[model samples]
Target: FRGRRGDTVKILWADADGLCLFTKRLEEGQFIWPAVRDGKVSITRSQLAMLLDKLDWRQPKTSSRNSLTML
Candidate 1:
């Protein structure tokens, strides 16, 4: 995943007999990221898919209105 400033992320995994590396970058826009904290965060499969598509995984739909109203 790339940060807001275009920082790229590299993922490494070990297979049966060797290691593999994968990377992805968006030509435009940034991946939706969780709040910065001490530990790691978890995301659902659908969220991951949305992220890969360069969409905001945090929100289900971009045009949806906020349910909360200001008093």
Candidate 2:
């Protein structure tokens, strides 16, 4: 999905209603593409959410702090 359609992405999957198609386009910059396998690209539901948020869905990062306690 490059060139004139670089900003757009399409997701196809099967659900209870049978087949479904989702299309989205970013206002600026193109969506980061995932690796393709056998001519197809795939990602998890969580990854999809991260992708939509303009985060690196391939390996999303989160900040964490270790708890300091004395028992």
Candidate 3:
């Protein structure tokens, strides 16, 4: 992740047709990050939403809706 606040980066991937890019940026704060295990980070859907919103994902105000995980 970018160290500086408001620094944006694009993720590039290739699909069946062609290359695709997705970009996400935080206007004010750093994204809430999850602990990495075995060089990978896994978080719940709710955590992702909170992270995207620049909120603290470690302790959510509401309970998690699903036990499923995301990377």
Candidate 4:
């Protein structure tokens, strides 16, 4: 998500032993990062999880029953 248009994503990790680098490329489509941030470099783990689930992590979900109104 280095502000480039592509499917490949690079991940860098460092542990006590050594550094690890990982990459994931989708066959189609692209992973989108938000453009509304004031100044942010990376997202939290929870945010990443929500993105992976195709949900908006920054907000709460509301449930409403339309059947009751119909009744």
Query: Number of the top candidate by lDDT?
Result: 2
Candidate 1 Cα errors over 4 Å, as ranges: 1-4, 13-18, 62-71
Q: Which pairs clash in the backbone of model 2? A: none
Q: Please tell me which predicted candidate would have the highest TM-score against the true structure.
A: 2
RMSD of each: 8.0, 3.7, 8.1, 6.4
Instruction: Kindly indicate the candidate among 3 and 4 with the higher TM-score.
Output: 4
lDDT, residue 23, model 1: 82
Instruction: TM-score winner between 1 and 3, please give it.
Output: 1
Q: Backbone clashes in each candidate structure, one number apiece?
A: 0, 0, 0, 0
- Cα displacement (Å) at residue 31, model 2: 0.5
Sequence-dependent TM-score of model 1: 0.56
User: Which residue runs of candidate 3 sit more than 4 Å off their true CA positions?
Assistant: 1-20, 62-71
Residue-level lDDT tens digits of model 1 in 3-62: 447534455669899988878776666667656556665667887677667777777785
lDDT against true structure, model 3: 0.65
lDDT of candidate 4 over 1-71, digit per residue (tens) = 44266456666788999988876666667665555466655688977765555456668375675335633
Q: What does candidate 2's lDDT look like per residue over 1-71, in tens digits?
A: 32355688767769788988777888888877777789776678888787767788867676656556678
